[model samples]
Target chain A: MNEAGTTVIEARNLDLTFQTNDGPIHALKDVNLAINKGDFVSFIGPSGCGKTTFLRCIAALETPTGGALTVNGMTPDEARRSRAYGYVFQAAGLYPWRTIAKNIKLPLEIMGYSSAEQDERVNKVLELVDLAGFGGKFPWQLSGGMQQRASIARALAFDADILLMDEPFGALDEIVRDHLNEQLLALWARTEKTIGFVTHSIPEAVYLSTKIVVMSPRPGRITDVIDSPLPKERPLDIRDTPEFIEVAHRVREGLRAGHGDDV
Target chain B: MKQIIAVLTVIAALVVVWYAACIPMNIKGVLTEQERAGAEVQPPSAKDRRDLSEIGLALNNSFAIPATWEQDRPRLPAPHQVAIELWETTVQKKITSKRSLIYHGWVTLSATMLGFAIGTGLGILLAVGIVHSRVMDLSVMPWAIVSQTIPIIALAPMIIVVLYSVGIQGIIPKAIISAYLSFFPVVVGMVKGLRSPDAMQLDLLRTYNASRSQGFWKLRLPASMPYLFTSLKIGVAASLVGAIVGELPTGAVAGLGARLLAGSYYGQTVQIWSALFAAAILAACLVGLLGLIERAVLKRMGMAQ
Candidate 1:
């Protein structure tokens, strides 16, 4: 650790279980991870691999059945209460009735930001997302990619220091996903904010993240933690480089090993 | 242009058919039979008598082209006849004249509005309660559905009688009946609307740590607008039915239902028809007005235009 307080997210031996009609279902087991401040970390795993569950726990949406998880050095619940992070769901989740501007202002309004400041922030984020002229439009009128961009702008509007994104670009086509991944990288660089992204795509995880946390299913646990070799200045061409492919191959090997498949 | 021309052609064909049907091909006047019995009868002009009888029948039937086409058809009074009667009763003699439809219409409108407000309020409250509690969902929803199954016509008189015994009359009784009929749609619509938010959106709000009231105000209520407005349209129409049904009992002197009753008693078919038409028009207008408000509110919220 660089400093005692430098870690933005730290979870130690986290475990989660659910009660079912048949019996207890172990969802997560003995997962440990630490994310540094301003780091872009992506968690990649198969279905039921607890990637989303872990993200939820960090966001305080789910309680870990065992172990301790802290965000910004505070308990998940406290951090949630303090609004320490902005969460972006897999779906856009834009309120259909609210305009683009209003949707972006939702968190700001809830946090009681002054109208002028809210408008200022909203405008800035809208411009940042390249949706400045579409402020008056509703979410339903926008294309899927545009809606996702709006959702990102919404998260950015609150100016939160940490972002917990659960497959934010999972629903987009490959082209849109690639485009969004680059834009997200650019956004992360500009904001210098810590981000925890959950995705299943190996290449996507390898391309965007400074650190990759590969997880395994069946009592989900971290299988590998791969520090990316690529530089901070990532461009679209970086995806085609030998270094990017090597990281992606490592991630694939890690996933196969976790699944007990020959690699 | 094609549609308008087709409609005009159909209307003109109907008029010709009506004129042909009413030409009095078989003249059977009472005077004609008497003249045929050859007892040195001083005969009136047969053609003149037939013409006079046809004119009388045309006047009675209000010169409606459709009416003259079918002998056994229910009397389809022409638009002019109904209009003439409506003008004489409503405008010539004002509402106090006891024959005025305006007075009856006001009475019915009052009852309908009162009932509509009460029903809508009750529906919203029940919907909120149902949304908040599982017990209310299990208990109140089934009974609300059952309440609608009880015919309004059957319930109206009993409601009137019950209210009368409890020292309630006039608007209250009528309003209660209207509310009873109108509330179910609002409840159903509102419940569906309130629960409309998707899992992802709800999770987003939960992640934000928004309170229950904040979530409801920010998400649920706004999400339910389209459903609520659609239900209000149905509720308003139902309330109008309730008001009319309420008037059927107690023989109220100043309501459209009472006008219908009086028209039936005096065999003034045109009066009853006009009153019925007016009630329909009022209900349509009320629904239209609510639709207008729905559009305005939704537009302001940046929903669909």
Candidate 2:
């Protein structure tokens, strides 16, 4: 993976412990990974496994108490300050008070993008996410799935090379999730941007990722890293193939193994 | 339409009940006076008293009740008396005249408006400061709460007297009192509002590497608006109360409170009732105006329908 191209994100023994009322909560421990340019990486794990936390660290939304994590050879904080990545949270998290167009333009407004540039980028991303005609509407006016798509549009609007998404469609129903998953694949095919995705679904991991990083809870650690053997351009029916099933099974076993440690 | 009908019906019923109540509350006072004005006839027969005016005290306990429906100094002035007084002072009299309710109302309204503006501005500033600084949060919040616990009436005299001694008198002192009453709700509301954005939203701003000032202006401030308006509504009503209370200790000769003092001293219950009603009406108007602004602003913000 390191041989494919220049590394976009590198985490060396990354560690984060949160000081809580109960005591210290070990959110991440010894997370070592390298994400190459234009790679689609999915971090699959159960809740409390630090998958979301790992994604946040890459975006500089959280600080690793120990270890070195860098984005594009810059510290995550520096990269963040330099407008390096666009992040999408678990929920759509659109400002309900703002119209969809304005919501998508929030980063642009903060980053001081010209109004013309903001409008152009907002329109482009809205069309990319298939929410082109709905930018005038507010988030609450849209359905849950549509709002999530709008959130994706918001993340895509800035033209950042890296998209850090934390379970962006986790709350959606299966039907919408499948549709979004396909749209997301098409989006990746078109943009060729490096993506860091967090998910709990095994099939989603196997279907979407060039690399799947499995994580474990309770002092959250990466248990296994599996490089996928699936074709780059995969259709929805590919999930029924033996190759896809085999990769999903491997991810499942990796997750079950992590759970086994708790027992 | 339905809501209007319901409210009007309630008002009408209240006035009816008020008119009915006037009979009992004023009847004893009415009858004793009527008895005093009657011709001396201690052992008079029913026929002797019948010659007196119909429904008079000279009925000699022969009838059910006297029809003394009107009295100049009744315990509870009839609804009509208050209405007539409200009309005579507000509509017929010139607005600038000392005898006019409009003049008194203007004096009080100016104080209320000035105080509300000051209180809201101060509360918002303090709230933002409290949200941004742990020191302000720890030291100022407790005192803000403590300030509210001291009743404004007790504080009013001291505030007025101190301001007077320093050559700041009249409206400013009253406005200060109004400001005191309105401060807490705005502080409480704004703090809640400034902190309303969740962890995820904060993270979104952090990812942008937004400045703290930018975070406050773009996110926290707008987010707190719904809360801000709610507090403003509460603060407006409180400000009016403060303004009226502020007038009491100063022995104001021109505001609604002055009218109340004069009415009470002269035993003009009608005048007092009219002044009280005017104050109530003023408070309602202030609150209603804030409600309209809240709806407009929140709706524009897409926070309300």
Candidate 3:
């Protein structure tokens, strides 16, 4: 759906290994993927699968032991130096001592955004997340879902072209997770920002992603990349639609395939 | 409420018992062997002299009248005596006056604050080193633990002597001792706190192309605030201990420790008690102040109430 010709991130034959007491744990092996500009992609698999490792490799948090990984046509490290993406963790990870507004302002301050620009972006993103008036509230005072929303707002505030989320809604209850999934779909539809989301939930991956990359464990490697057939204009009611079910089924199949199950 | 009431009741009973125990129960202030030999020594007070006339009368009078009510037995120096002493030391005399509790308190306080600052700074640095490097962890962590095992009381005199040899007498030597004792908690707290971020969070930062320093400032340091504050409270208390210990060995002319020594030498029990109370109050105030700062910092970070 991304008409943009630019490939935002490209990983080719990427391999990553961690030296453990037992032996070297191969976290990733010969992984290849490309994310186009404004694309929404999800990496989904069972625990210890290469989904997280792949995500980390793309983020340049972990260096690939072999092969090349690039973001915005540059090395991950180069992209990082250029401040190319915004990241949201599984947990909200908001500083407890900070108000929502201050927490959002932290990256902005570090990245050297002017106060006025920081204020503008903070207000805009807070409004985008439906948390305009709740800026003064601490993360603990808010519900778990709200804290996650605040963190999302913090990522959005920077207005980066890419947003990297690692199971951002994993801790929320099903209802809240459903609500957040819908909100996330809407946000993606509006911003058209490139997203590489990591999740364990098939429904969540199918609901929000344009592309879902399924991975397997024990020397983590990608098994399949399933492109969703559902329409881009997603709504809360879309989850009940036949087309949505078809995509979810496909993601489930991809996950089963990744687990080395015939599907 | 019940706990508070029980504690108060216990304290009241203890006071009553203390008064009873101090009363002349047929024996008076450890009679000398010579006096016990029927030498007929003159009693120090007329009450004692009068009571000696009749054994039953003396015993009855001593038991019947409240020991505090009797002229001889000033039982616990009456609350007013302590109040008068406190007023004269803290209010009547200026804080800087040589005889003032505030003056001695300031000496202890200055050392505590200095030591706390040094300890906290050193602890943070050491924690960072340990967290970042396995070499430092293997090399420094064991020593840090070993350092704590050495009783501060045993080390205080050696610390003073070493500093004196280097021509570094006065506040610096005392402050160093305070810092030595105060840093351990901070190092431990900060190390735990700095590493508190989960794997996913670290990945999130990496995905953003954030460098190590960026990740630290943007993530680790902020995450460590709660831990740092908790350690600071502990560190402040330890710093006070260090400062007091520092005062003990050097024969410092001023400070709560010096006041204690002087009071003990002259048998001014009340002065020693007052000085001990003053030191406790100073430590409490310092810790309370650090707590206030912690609250403010945390609130600013969107963490605390």
Candidate 4:
């Protein structure tokens, strides 16, 4: 296992170009970054900025056309084959056919967990996401926030060391997003998992992430990477603090700088 | 409550139109019969009656109007005439009797059910193959569509004649034709269903390091249930039509198709209409049964929406 502060995911001059009928599309270009163990890293940028694309590259969901990207000291493909991470997409995407408990147990069942062990893990993760008594309910029976929470529980159920979330709360409202952000921080604190989050919100990137990588569109490249100076413990009111605002301002400046020629 | 009223209103309109149509259709026959019984008819001559409008002749001879509904063999049987025949064949006659609609319906239904099972099984297998292999998708899909374009009516007789030459006869030939009509819809529907999972869902399974089979049993199969039931409804109805058509070429004496042929030969329009109604009723029941099963299964799976 990699120690805290050790590099868990490293991307060097990574580039990806999609071949469409029109021509070639540069989805990612010269993207360079390192995500350390137990770090809550947020890739913040607008749509088409390759933040989600970069996260996907680390999860081996998309193959980069050029450069090197490694996860847990091995290639992303090898890490994925070894079941290195759990991914949460923008939608909850829970199978409507399965109840919350069964949905949580899906990856465990796929990974060939023992039946008793699967039950134990499902119960534990359900509680971890504050959905203790709702395991028997179907996904549609729950609200959007609860369904997304159940999705989070599903990702956490297999106990993977890496969690890759691509705008998991993007579909949620502001109040729900804030509550989930706090819960996510608490989850990270307890699990000590390396999380790579992609989002378009500056306050979200500033609040939850220990490291914020600001990115821009048009041939997708990194604009800045800001390491936060705040303590690990955070609350909803922490957004009002000067230090939080300062980091948020820096993220905003980087975003503006990335949009320079276009704006 | 509102729906029942709407349905009843439609039925009433149909019956009224049907009775009015019978007046025009059977007017000449009624007038001829009335003239033979020493009654005066309009135009006074059979040759002159042929040249005038049937509706005009019916209005001029108002005394013969009531007899038009009671014709022994009219061009179009009145609604009540067909209804009485349906009741006699289905309810009045014993189910074991050859004249009973229930007996003929059962024979046709057996073939339809057999063919439906075979078609559904073959369709699902082909769909699975197509979804899994690009070669199967490229080759089999176009052939499946082309098979549907070839009229089953033209194909049914050849199948029956070919099978009759061999020892393979009766239900199997009819069932094969039924299966042929049915399998295409199932293949198209199941293929769509099996591939219903979005890219994100597939990517989620990929992230879990799930194998191809795991992705299928866990996601694809369950996702396909709704589509499967929908296709089954269509397939079952098609199967009934195929079975009825299959009975036509062989001059089979035991099914609804035989009943239709016999009725037509004797100019028994009432019998033909009754048999048509029976076949339609059978098809409706099969589709309704499938719908009930769909609701139950989807409700159990919590996929009703």
Best by TM-score: 4
Worst 10 residues of 1 chain B by lDDT: B65-74
lDDT of 4 by residue, A125-231 (tens): 99899999999999999999999999999999886799999999999999999999999999999999999999999999899999999999988999999999879
For each candidate, what is the lDDT? 0.84, 0.89, 0.81, 0.93
Better of 1 and 2 by DockQ: 2
Candidate 1 lands at a TM-score of 0.85
The best candidate in terms of lDDT: 4
lDDT of 2 at B249: 81
Give each prediction's DockQ, rounded to 2 decimals.
0.68, 0.83, 0.48, 0.91
Per-residue CA lDDT of model 1 for B1-305, tens digit only, reads 99999999998887666445443422233234435654222224566455465545434434333433332212444445565767776778766766777777888999999999999999999999999899999999999999989888888889889888999887999999999989999999999999999888788887777888888999999999999999999999999999998998788887888888887887666778688878888899999999999999988887875
> Which runs in model 4 stand beyond 4 Å of their true positions?
none
Docking quality of model 2: it rates as: high
Q: Write the per-residue lDDT of candidate 2 for residues B133-153, one digit (tens) a residue.
A: 999999999999999999888
**How many angstroms is residue B259 displaced in model 2 relative to the true structure, after the best TM-score fit?**
0.7
lDDT of 1 by residue, A73-152 (tens): 89999998988999989989898888899999898888889999999999999988878989889898999999999999
lDDT (10s digit) by residue, model 3, range B210-301: 57888888788989989999999999999998998899877789998888888777766567767877888888888899899998887666
- Better candidate number, 1 or 4, judged by DockQ: 4
True contacts kept of 4: 0.91
Please give each candidate's TM-score.
0.85, 0.93, 0.80, 0.98
Q: How close is candidate 4 to the true structure, as a TM-score?
A: 0.98
TM-score between predicted and true chain B, model 4? 0.98
